[model samples]
Target: IVIGSGDLAAGIADQLRAHPDIGYDVVGIVPETPDPEEGAVSLGEVEDLPRLVREHRVSDILFVGAGHPDRVLGTLLVKLADAPVTIRVLTDLESITLSQGVAEEFLNLPMLRFERRNLVHLRPWLKRVADFLAAAALLVVTFPVQAVLIVAGLLARPALAWEERHDYRGYPHRIPLFHDPGTGWRGALFRALPPLRYLPSLWPILTGALSFVGPYPEEPDENRAMEDWNLILTRLKPGVLDVTSIADHPWVPFRDPAGLNMYYLQHWSIGLDLQIVLKESLRVWDKEEGESRHG
Candidate 1:
């Protein structure tokens, strides 16, 4: 069961609904009215979250809400401390890293289930919805800013700004503006407004070349070099944003990278994916914002 009736809640419900082995059911409870979507039903207000869990025999509960996820999550934890319901919390807030105090109380109930979560029955459908809304919102908000940045960068550093250069074999590679490089404008625009990076990959995602959330795609040669490690990371499609990319970890050894991805895959869930995506979006956005300011 998932609590809260916001997008995150809906996304989680979508994941649970997709997992066949889990045999999961979702109950969305909001302070106001709720909409019944897929296998989920409205369970009234936040006060009724525990009751819904009990009634539905829910083995797991994911918290997907808007505004101050930690605060909302803390409240739910306090309320359900003695309710015998395992809970998961989702958030985009970067301030309050999950505290050990809270994690101890909840016993870290919302475990990440990277791979298994993908096996979920409703995941494909739910991910499509979440991707659509997220990409649409991003495009709407950033397109203009991106266009301005592109024009400015093209005029200022028409030679493909030194920093914007892509390096292959550790050598700087720049495509000229005089000749239309199909990827030039769009690439510069995305690099300037990194939030739209996902826009380019949306089609690949829909076509199964990508997963809703996973490792960022490595360059082909780099990908091939890690034949051994590929055993680990190759199982999933590259996500536009992911743990390694978000964490800004350099030297992503072979495949395991200190077994982070392995652990991530083992404990991945829709909530975890939400957390990672949000974190990555911030990192990417900030990097671009910094570049824009400097440029």
Candidate 2:
């Protein structure tokens, strides 16, 4: 639907009608003054844009007519803020250059495009959504085992206390380590079940405190390999699993040397996370097979 007033409105409508190959079918016009002589049927008034869009099932709306002066365009845009339609508003080239807008030249005129919220860029957001879904699934799979361990750990408080750490953006967070204090054979036993030990981390990932990939959170006062590298790494949400953690012995004191952690951060993506997980899984499978052969 085109929203405009006067002969200029007729000219814009004529241009749109002649250019059917441009991939738009102008159903009608929404004129400020009801015109019986107008070629396109009047849809409605400018104030009724949202309702008219819904009633006419409008997928494209343009503000090219003189009735839509730039001063009132902002208010009109706000009215259709949530409308599921592509909005094109005629604006000066300088305005498009100064502000973030999708502009295109048509008929020697600049038109700025506004799209629905759902169609925005999906790069980093894609990873965040994936992390949430993956963490939720992990919780569903590990909940039963975690419940039993929680009961036992409660019986033995000395198993390990919650460790405090700093996550992305320097936000302080606490995580379960399930660290056995090396006081008894029971400690050794719990340490042997590595998967059970880190199962608690899925809850944090689901809560947005962590991710399935990225640097592990460091202790509050732990020394960093390079202050700059450590500062840069904190930009990402801390994860329970990282290549450094996966490659090292499960029982060894975990350390995120700057070089390796930086590499993971530099090339970070969903694909890198999946590759690390696959590599670790294969390592465990190989270890188990070797043990079985020896036994």
lDDT of 2: 0.60
> lDDT at 190 for candidate 1?
64
- Local distance difference test, per candidate? 0.50, 0.60
Best by TM-score: 2
Residues 144-259, model 2: lDDT tens digits: 86676677677876444576555643356678756555546445544454345566777787888877666654455555454554565665676555556433332211133543
> What digit string (tens of lDDT, one per residue) describes model 1 on residues 95-123?
22232123233365644323322322223
**TM-score of every model versus the real structure:** 0.33, 0.39
Q: What is the lDDT of residue 86 in candidate 1?
A: 71
